[model samples]
Target: MRFTLSALALILTVAASSMTAGQSTSGQPPVTFTKDVAPIFQNNCQVCHRPGSIAPMSLLTYEDARPWARSIKQKVLAREMPPWFIDKNVGVQHFANDRSLGDRDVQTISAWVDAGAPEGNPADMPPPRQFPAAEVWQIGQPDVVVSLPKDYIVPAKAPDRWPDILVDPHLTEDRYIKAVQIIPTKGFTVIHHIRTSIVEPTDATLGSGKLDDADVPLEVGEQGVFLNEYAIGKQGDVFPDGSGRMIKAGTKINFQMHLHATGKEDTPTNVMLGLKFYPKGYTPNHAINSTTVSAREVDIRPHTDNVRSDGYLTLKKAARLLSFQPHMHNRGKAECLEAIYPSGKVETLSCASFRFNWHLNYVYADDVAPLLPAGTVLHSIMWHNNSASNPFNPDPDAQITYGQRTIDEMASAWISWYFMSDQDLKKEMDARHAAKTVPTSTR
Candidate 1:
């Protein structure tokens, strides 16, 4: 939440400026793989495009990329690769983990392909980047790791599975958690998402080593504190400095696993969630909180191109905003978040050009986090396109509503923040106002 984005900004900026810094600036000098495109892929695409990852093909090597040169050029030109959909021309464009390609990089790749996709001298290539192993912990080792009681079998051709498991950490004392990472042992290939919550269900036999009901999502009142979630391309949860989420001593961890079918024979998986606790006796300056604002009630007319819905939430107390994740289904077109202050002034917090396939979490830079006092209402607006023009839309003639399947539509904004006192909130507001008056560069 409070991390610097200078590194990622540098990656985007330098990749743009370096292309024309000392070169002829005349005729482009025959852009080639080693000389032009490799570094761009290394910094931006290899994370998900490599082996054992979610992407269908790897771009880590020249041989791997040569076959897909034209396709790569097309995707990048369309701003579809690297899977970043934040509207660059819209609200707060600087994010901590932005992986979108710069215009210059895209141009470079296009030119390289136009010139027959030449392979420059191998000696000119830079050192290959080192990525964490597929099964290794993204954040270092955790304080404790808990796994599912038994491996769950996912049939080859079945409806989407929502297998819920109960995990009890059995803590004798309250623990302040700094981070949590959920890893799918053998199900990463077919796993859609994994959500965890801290709950104290009244049922005494819940965590009795048996799979819970699949319709657990409908029971909102029984759900506990929102902990964290894991989806494709999401690097686990690591709280900013001086912030933590508390867990009561007797609380049970509820694991809601969403497994998708890969069209293969029975596959088994044992998912795990790792917890990193803060040192004992250390109190955090702020307590992290999360809320999922969803507009469950929606009526989308058949063949509609611009169906819209708005979900609203008004805060009870002051809090410092940390991050946001805007979600929608296949027909989703765009997502936006706005803040309406007590004075009736509205400010755009963040907006992303939504794509159903790539669900991204946008974490704001620490310096940009605004302090919202009581009565500040947050608006989450989502736009959908269920017409024939939308290639991802499964059916353009059926009215859509909120349901558990992907074909059914959903509109939600998962917001994360930390509670702060009024006095501290004022200080943050003052700092934000003072910083705004100064001239700033556009993203």
Candidate 2:
């Protein structure tokens, strides 16, 4: 009787093993490219994944994408490729071109990869979408195109150098702008980042009328106001609803270019800003406000894996957030950006998964505006790497601080917003339309 019982137990174990294997292999339905995977890629990845885009590869077609099927599946499942830095569980924030993939979308792509990446029926395939040409300005035509007067040379043998350049596009009278776009004329390799500022003439003797000379020297931080700042892998600021900062007459635009030499000698770069103007009597709906967080001095022990630097800022009043941009340099360990509201509702603005090369400004859509009440505290946590494996590490032994160079590190989160009241926005618009001078330094 004991022998019979042992045999029966072995038989049942074999049956269970077979059933598990069958369920694993046969239970999942097959996924198709035309129906499942294509839609996801088209929606999320195609913006930067198309031909001639900044992305390393393309995912426009099944044939072009088939080779990377497994890679796509893995990266999406790992949540690394779409490059979003937000924690969705806290609050719903929708970006203009949101790359966040849903669980269902990920599952569909994974199943499609497992099903041998089948090309579904041609009739069911969606129409192929066309991508805009590279280097083409998105807003059709610009009203004013300002380029560097002369090419600036980048010294060879300098791995990373930050150069502050003054580009004087002298205008006669004050000009109101709606949208601004930056176009890199040359030296794409060495030019890693550019920060543009508007400099108003402090000296009345310098010029009152339109200046004909291109090389005009204007004080940067003296009397004029700083308009907007832009960086690499990001678009220039656009005040679509007539909300951009004004450039007063006799002001010059300063282009502070940050170049990474990359061991090459003497690179020359020229940059241009294409400006779009709003029609007369138009006013912008929103204004942009930025809060910068940095770590200039912090004790980091050698050989430590995750050295952290923290900073916090509390909002004095309520504001409607329009967009967010997170900045970090090489050797950056990790970062968490979030806001704690007055009511204790915490919203995760962005949480980057430790990559310094892919820094970008995340722009949100209209439907999901992250509203911050008064007494909200914005928190930032930055990490650093002082190890040998880091390629961009300037010195593993020495301490680093906040600077423009790649060797030195920085942590900054810039948030842009419009005023809360529609009536106030309209009032500002009416004043701007009348060409009435409202104090730009009010903020």
Give the best candidate by TM-score.
1
Summarize candidate 1's per-residue lDDT along 1-443 as a digit string, tens digits: 11236646745674665555334455456677887789999888887787756577899889999999889978987778878777665467666667789877877887787677888889878899897555667766888787877888889888666667778878667778898888888866667678777774343332211112111112143245457777665668788879988766777887777776667677787777888889998889987766655675678999898788988877767777788888777899888888888888887777787876566778777776656777788888988999998877889998998765677878878777777888888776676667783112211
Q: Which residue pairs in candidate 1 collide?
A: none
User: TM-score of predicted model 1?
Assistant: 0.80
Candidate 1 lDDT: 0.73
Q: Model 2, which residues run further than 4 Å from truth?
A: 1-29, 119-127, 134-137, 150-166, 172-175, 183-242, 249-271, 278-286, 340-349, 388-398, 418-443
Q: Best-fitting candidate, measured by lDDT?
A: 1
Model 1 / residue 45 / CA error / Å: 1.4
- Model 1 bad stretches (over 4 Å): 1-25, 138-140, 154-173, 187-193, 199-226, 231-235, 249-266, 279-283, 405-407, 433-443
RMSD (Cα, Å) of model 2 = 12.0
